[model samples]
Target: MTDATHRRPSRLPTRLLGACLALALLLAHQPARADDALMAGVHAFLYEQAQAHGEDVVIEVRPPSARLPACEAPQPFLTHASQPVLGRVSVGVRCGAEGRQVRYLQAEVGVIGDYPVAAREIAPGTAITADLLETRRGDLSRLPRQAVLDEAEVLGQVARRPLAAGSPLQAHQVQARALVERGQKVTVEAQGPSFRVTREGEALEPGGEGERVRVRFTNRELVTATVIGDARLAVDL
Candidate 1:
């Protein structure tokens, strides 16, 4: 009798085997596990390819001159395997999705591009790329264009007078300087018979001219005086 026995049929078909192999490869390429928790986070991903053919895809980035805040994620979602994360993102400016012109895009970690992306994660010192896009609207607005206005700044003093359009602003009017303190030793000069002893104890540091200054006497009494010429002082009765 012949030793060779009849061969058993293969469990999987040729096409089925090939499909199984392809599926396995795809699974391997993806993350080991998908995050199910939906926490508020940013999602900045570049399209694999550009959509419109022969169309200019321009990306406008805000330069460091303005110093904008971080780009935020649009929705609450889990992290994707391919997405770049800068860790613990928060609610930033909201960005537009799939539009020729987008306004107020929330800042994100960073964005890639199918159409030559120049997008990046916005931060304190991030340099913005000046790429103006000529669309129906103005320049493409990114997630963050300007810095975050803190509570102090938001409620800070505004221009008391109405500013006309295209008016040049002076630095002093916009910002207030530090005021002088009490008991600061100021230099006074002796002129004529009256040894112009600046009727007081000490003067405030950086004492302002024509500004009120508090003078403490040896008796611990407070007397207000006026700052006159350079280092000169006059007691205000």
Candidate 2:
């Protein structure tokens, strides 16, 4: 067990000892089963799965109030793959070989880690710099779904709205600083395997890095390209 708590011993009857011995033999002959201790299996599954995002994980699985039938060959799965797996998560368990009987369990996946927060109040349109941000450690799952953990995603970005000091930075509150402006002359590059072409064009719209911009070439032809740098855009051939 990766983690555990000690509990005082309780008296057991002589007949129960024989039953425990038989159960131990059963487990020895079979593969590890989540059904042995339902919550234990769920925690193990979540901890292992959450390891991809962070090393330190704390999980809490809530058992249903109603008694559940013993599960044979229990297989656990995430109920909402598109939704956030942290905080409150729904996990589904398939009981028996055919997986016809399904049950859902609620869980909280708390990953302890440090995330960047605003060191000072940042006004709208302010470009983020390392000096303006500080790190705070806590349960990452308790943070906003769009919280920005990677400093690279925050630095040099323009804030879309005011952020208070010590506030957790989220993805929705920031935007890439505009790299190309309307009516600006831009270098348009179209590239393909083993070939590349560069042409001069005028941007018809303002855009940030990785953003799409419409441009008109000297030939009066229009094309949409992705902004890669200041006054630079690219289109895949």
Candidate 3:
């Protein structure tokens, strides 16, 4: 009897088989979901933008419920109207092989920290004090625009409106106390490169520090001066 050898048939050629294996490996190394790639890109972009503002930002990228096709290169960018880069803002993420395919995802970015909040019901015109203000850890994205983050910013400043207890402080709700009163006598000091002059004058308008006020001098000379301190104004000569 002649010896017989059994042979197995190959489903794919050697080159084709190698290609399949390479593709499988590539997919395995990539992110399992397209949203994951998009989320990462958006997080990185927001982090870089926030860092430029001298803030240590904590960001959370909300995942999209809709499924996205697999993409090779993903890019994240801010919308044109998303100015100031604070509070609730939308970020766009584009993903595709060559920019031919693109999908945009909206993510919520927030800064994590202790922000100023009213500890008691503060009446309008009341100066903010340390005892009446407290810091609370919260998401800054949901907070109001121009929210006060530091207590020092509102301290010694008069409230523009009544604030309820536990309410967050906002920049628009506070104003610097007036340093010069209208019709009050003020010292007008003019300084130049080589000379300095001082005269007693009457203020025409109430002004805070660094604010401009019109002053009438003893000689009835009218001049605009910047309030530098209590009863003090400076004019550039």
Candidate 4:
């Protein structure tokens, strides 16, 4: 009745104390309905549905607007850096939300200050198989430099008898086993120690003694020998 009825009852308790302080700051920033931690590992900039693998994202680790450049001989996983970066990182992962109130279940291996990375490379190590995360480039490196049949090199034998391992190289009945160079010489018509040829070439066909004869030399190289008979004519290397 006076002062507009006491300011309409004091504006309804000041709008009910500002609606109870905005509902307690939105329930204290929500997120925690049981907390199983659905997933999180965004080391930095990542969007294609959070690098898809399961995708359900809601990440918020904070503190990496960008940082990717620190792999000098870092050849372990194959790609993380080899040169060319503006902001390097290594944790990266995402996927969470659906039934809980706020979770991020899987994605460990994080450290912007220590460096650990080995939780099975991020979950995986219990007899793991799928070729164990398969990845082969130079695979293990080494054990691939023994196919050097030089000295006129050119071999492809197995012209008339046996030839396994996906055999398929027939040139006029296969016959060109060339290789014998050190001083050069041929003609041994089978027998005992007649040694004298330093080097020669050609005869990449005709197999016997132990089979597998495909030699053709002359700096051409195509060897595959095994037949050490028929008087080899000369073979120093």
Candidate 5:
């Protein structure tokens, strides 16, 4: 074989090897997967915010239907300034060497727990009871800001307004039920570090437990006392 014939056969293999290496390098420099980038961006944003708020929360990030362009660095942010990080919200994913490309996705965050709800229509001033309330597993972040998270919070509390059946109970919508009625006879107890004394008195206002009420003693003296229970008041001597 001549020198030209030997060179020709080796040239084909050399070209083939060079092509394979170029292809590999091209792929290696390419951006990361769109779903993975988006997910990482969103999760990091949400996780940091949740940690800052001291909330033990689970964040579920939904991938965008449209594939995002490859990016060197991805950053996620809220779509709206007032949009809360909790519940159903939209997040914007930005990618670029210095924040050039941008995209958006939807996500949900929830505090996994059982929350209280009204089992029946509750009238204003009606005291909440076990039979009138129910518990449901839900994302606490999706609920209202004042939503009651525990059954104990709503029980024994009176509704401040008309509550629809199946509606979530809120902390601001309930108050402790009145334990002492207006003009009712009550036993006023005066207690201190040294001694305790009990006397008969009349309630001048309706109040719940731990609430302040005025009482008129048999001696025609008015004293401010804290309602302790049904027809009962406690005064510090």
Candidate 6:
């Protein structure tokens, strides 16, 4: 009788397979881990945008409660581009190169920055001087909508209504001082990348700085231009 020794097949491969299966199961239940990265990406984007406006931003990002498909390469943008980034906002996010997954996120952005306030009691129709305006630091997110943030925006402008001392000014509280009058000869500057052309045009309507006014050129060409300064208008070509 010949003695034959049988060798047992290795169980190492079976153990490795079992580990992989366990990992897959664990990952399936923890889909929100990817969402954590997604929200982080969203926060970074919002923080950068807010920083561009010269504000110290504190962003509170809220993740979606529902489980979402595993996402990679997340991109975030303002859902309403015209709306201010402060306070509670809705952000739209796109995932992957194809952007096949689109999701909306809610967030609260605290913007700490300087805003213009009345240095003293301002009466209506009073021309705002630098002495009359003071800078106040606070969370701009809590300010009234359209609150003035830049001192340049109010300097030389006229108050539309009475403002209390040390109170933040809003867009409705002031008006740009009228600089161009109707039928006045205004210099219409058409500027381009390479050159600038200026022509004299009669203003069809009165406009203040940063306001749009209609101008009629000598050739009877009517165009709308922005008032840049006193009797000055510009058109970008």
User: Model 1, stretches more than 4 Å misplaced?
Assistant: 1-167, 170-181, 187-200, 204-207, 229-231
Per-residue lDDT over 1-237 for candidate 5, one digit per residue giving the tens place of the 0 to 100 score: 656534434355778989999999877654445577668778888878655333678888887776446655787888876654677878887788778788778888766667778898999989899999887876678789667766887788999999999999888899988999999999999888888899999899999999999999889999999998899899976
Cα deviation at 234, candidate 3, in Å, is 1.0
**For residues 1-237, could you state the per-residue lDDT of candidate 1 as single tens digits?**
879889987689889999999999877643322211111222322111111212233322222222233333333222333322222223222333422221232222332222222223222222222221111221222222221111132122233234333222222222222134455655443355645444436654544556766666566775666667554566633
Worst 10 residues of 5 by lDDT: 3-12
Which prediction has the highest lDDT against the true structure?
6
Q: What is the C-alpha lDDT of each candidate?
A: 0.35, 0.87, 0.80, 0.31, 0.81, 0.88
| Per-model TM values vs. the true structure | 0.22, 0.73, 0.66, 0.20, 0.55, 0.71
lDDT of 3: 0.80
Poorest lDDT segment (10 consecutive residues) of candidate 2: 27-36
Deviation from native of the Cα of residue 93 in model 5, angstroms: 26
Listed per model in order, the count of residue pairs whose N, CA or C atoms clash below 3 Å is 15, 0, 0, 46, 0, 0
- What's model 6's lDDT at 142? 94
Best by TM-score: 2
Candidates sorted by lDDT, best first:
6, 2, 5, 3, 1, 4
Cα displacement (Å) at residue 111, model 4:
7.8
TM-score quality measure for candidate 3: 0.66
Best-to-worst order by TM-score is 2, 6, 3, 5, 1, 4
In candidate 6, stretches whose alpha carbon ends up further than 4 angstroms from where it belongs are: 1-29, 53-56, 182-204, 214-237
What digit string (tens of lDDT, one per residue) describes model 2 on residues 191-236? 8888889999999999999999999998999999999999999996
Q: Tell me which of candidates 1 and 2 scores higher on TM-score.
A: 2
Candidate 6 per-residue C-alpha lDDT over 1-237 given as tens digits, one digit per residue, 9 for 90 to 100: 999999987666888999999999888768767888888988988888787555688999998978888666777889999878888989999888988888999999998888888899999989999999888888989999888888897788899899999999888888988899999999999888788899999999999988899999999999999999989999866
- Between prediction 4 and prediction 6, the one with superior lDDT is 6
